[model samples]
Structures are given as C-alpha cells and as structure tokens.
Target: MQNDNMKCGLIEKTESQFVDSIEKEAYVWCEKNWKHDDYEHQHNRAQLTFVEEGYQYFHIDRKIYLVPQHHVIWIPSEKAHKITSEAQTVNLMVFLFKSVFEDEFYQNVQVFAVPPVLKEMLLYASKWNQSLDENEEQDLFFKAILKSLPNFCKESSSLEIPVPTDTRLIPVCNDINVNFKYNLDIDSLAEKAQMSVRSLQRIFKNETGITLQKYLQLTRILKSIELIDTRQYTLSEVAYKVGYQSLSAFTSSYFAIMQVKPKINKN
Candidate 1:
C-alpha cells in the first residue's frame, strides 16, 4: 500500500536542488612576501587581510593601524590605503565584491575577532582561490561564510600607530626605525628635520595624531614584539635589544602598547 506521493520518488532529491543557488562574485587567496611596501592605492573591491606570520602596518585615511599575526584587517572598497610589512609574512587575502553583501558591510575599516570557526572558514575559503562558479560544495562553503558572518565575530581593540606623511618628517621616521635601540632626543629629531623643537612638536601632533614620545615608545615596543615572536630572545634580551634600560620599564611600555605583558618562552 505505497502512497502515490512516496512512490513518485520524491525522497530521492539531490542536495544541490534544495540549497539556494548564488552567483559567486568574490575570491580568496593566500600570499607570502619578504619585506615589501606598496604605495597608496584604491580598488573597486573590498579587501580583508588575515595576518599569518609577522606584523602589518596599514595606513588608511591618514591613520595607521598595526595588524598583528592571527588578526584580520578589513579595508573597504575604493579606499586609498597603503600596507607595509615588518618582516617576511604570510597573508590570507579575500577580495569581496560589493554586490554580495549589504552596503553597510563595506563601510568602515575594521579589525575583527577571528573565533575558531570563523578562522577555519577563512582558511578553507582561501583554498578556493576563485569564484564558486556553480560548484555545489564550494557554493555551500561560501554560503556558510555569509551565514556565519553576523554572529560569529565581534570587534576587538584596534592597534593603531600613527605615522606622519610630511616629507620633512621622513628622515626622522627613518632614523627612529633604523636605530631604535638608541635613545632618540627631540632636539636631535628637530635638528634632523631642520626645524625648531617647538615647530616639530606642533607639526608632528597636527599631522600624526600622536605625540612624538608616544610614537617613539610605540615603535620600540612594536620592534620588541617582532623580536619576541621569534622565540629566540629572553625578556631581558629583548628589552636590551630595544634600548630599554630596565626590564620593568620595557614590561610597562609593552603592556601599555599591547595591553598584555609579553609571555616569555624560556625554552
């Protein structure tokens, strides 16, 4: 006594037919580079970068942000931005087409919290390296990403380090980066920039959005972070390498900049 509806093979439907089909309008991929910096540029598609190796510095809309390893930085479409790397690093970059999501999704620069599920999805998406193009499994994965976007993540504390673009300050910036181990004085920086100390202070603040003292401190702390991540140096050694006179001072500055004391690996 098989029912006519059951006998009509209604239960044999394939999975693809039930899932809503979507046009793939985006891409994801991973890339590695050895110390590179790019000039400011804008694009029609939004970019999300997940750092895998070293620190990334992003300058967007006159402010700079520090993108540390395991973090994702999102740059909205058509925004002029520049990226610089501290060392050799890997980045999982996803370019999302504006048509795939709401306009609000592509509005601001954001640093997102990457929970385990989202992290795994990002990695999985990176493997596609191309649009889904009617592929069922890939389409499902992409669809899952869109579904998980709303509840899977939250905003974290932004790591911003402002850098001035004034050409007069370029030499000063280079000196600090190249010889960060030395105690740099404002007098010397002003002399190097061929301006009075007061003038330098005024202009630096007006242009960079951070005091010179804090900027220098942040630069050293960031360098210390890079050294510590190598796992080859002790806390004291890293402190000395970055020109901190005492471990206590270095730890204070590190905590101030990073919001956590560095976890030393004594192995």
Candidate 2:
C-alpha cells in the first residue's frame, strides 16, 4: 500500500491538474465520489457548488458551513476556503463564473436550499464544461442562471459554526466538536482550556461573537443534521447521538437553526 505522504502527493497533483484544466470564463464540473484533503485555496472567479448526494463541510471566512445533500453554497471570488467531505461517495456539481456581476447576491458566502427549478437548471448545465465555446448563446445561458440565483436562493440556512481565532479557545472548540455527544458544560470546558469560567465565556464571545452555551448548542445541531442525512438512524437516535435526551428538544433546536424540520429518509 502507498504511504500517507505518497497518497497526499498524488491527490495534490490530481487536484492541481484538475484546476489547471478549467481555466475558462465559465465552467461546470460534476463528479461522484469526490474526496480530497482539507486544502485551503482561493479562486479568482466566484464559485457555486451543489451537493447532490453527500455532504461537504466548507471552511471559509472563519466559519465552518455544512453543505448537506440537495443544498447549494456560493463562495465569492478571492475568498480563502477549504472543503472536507467525510463521505466516501459524494455527488457534487460546481459552477465557476467570472466575477463580473455587481449584484449583492454574489458578494457573500451563502448556503441555501435548492428549489426544483434551480435543481433542474444545475443538472442541465452539468453537461457543459470549460471547453464550451464562448459565444452569445453560452453567455446568455450562464447569465440566465446568474440572474435566477437571487430569486431561487433566498432562504439561506445557518448551518454554520463560527471558528474562534484565539489560541486559548481553539482547544475548547475542538473538544466540543469531537465530544459533541457528551454533555459538555461551561465549567468542564473552562477547565480543559485552563482558564477561569468567566474569562472563557467572555473571550469566547468576544472572539466568535457567540456565547459558549449557544456555540455548544449550534455544534450539537450541526452534528444532528449530519447524522439525519446518513439515513442509518432514526430521529430519536440522531437526537441522542447529538447529546439531546429529549427528542422534542432536539427537534426544536434543529428547526430553529435549519428553518425546516428534520427530514427522516425512510428508505
């Protein structure tokens, strides 16, 4: 078997070749089983990625956003970001466009639900790649998609957790993420971070703009969403897996963050 360094080198080389092949004014790339290391990079062109089958975690702008299945995420030009897909097989569709539009919609990172019409459009566009001729027809087709984005991508979801840059809080956040299934109280977190409870609370809020309790709650909800998407567990099982003893409480928190009910895939 190849060693870890060899595997990483091969993946990086493959990614570099892939990026070099798509230097176009507009491009569409689709893939299945798309797995890559957490490579942080930025593009000169704005990007929109649709997760069709599996989920992806987008680390951008000091926040980690969960782009679950059937959701789309927009990343503006020159924004530093990295993506991690834990799933073994992920179906993804990506669109890259020149940052020519002055619309406010393309100015910020957003993860939103994909409506049926938009979904169809994305699927149809998947046939075209960077090699497509740059003519008026092609321009119009891409422009139509751009214009329609602001309309269809209105309901943004807050499936994100702000990351703190402070050194003292990094381990705290990591612990919460890794041990999300446990009831991690402030006192324990403070102890782990080797700080007073009040200092931890104040500094965490100052750095991440969210209280420790709220941050923990958001972390649990994010994990629950991932578990629910897997279809391997019931809703109650998902709730408990994310540290909630009460299913109703889990449902409430999930809805509040996602703005939609937990979709239990009964397949």
Clashes of 2: 0
The local distance difference test score of each candidate is: 0.68, 0.77
Count of backbone clashes, every candidate in sequence: 0, 0
Which pairs of residues collide in candidate 1? Answer: none
Model 1 worst lDDT run, 10 consecutive residues: 7-16
lDDT, candidate 1, at 65: 78
Q: How close to the true structure is residue 154 of candidate 1, measured as C-alpha lDDT?
A: 60
Error of 2 at 76 (Å): 1.6
What are the per-residue Cα lDDT tens digits for candidate 1 across 149-215?
6465465433676667898998888888887898878899999999999999999888877777777
After superposition, candidate 1 runs with Cα above 4 Å error: 1-23, 31-41, 59-64, 89-95, 100-105, 112-117, 124-131, 135-158, 264-267
Model 2 TM-score relative to the real fold: 0.85
TM-scores of the candidates in the order shown: 0.70, 0.85
Each prediction's RMSD over C-alphas, in Å, is 12.0, 4.6
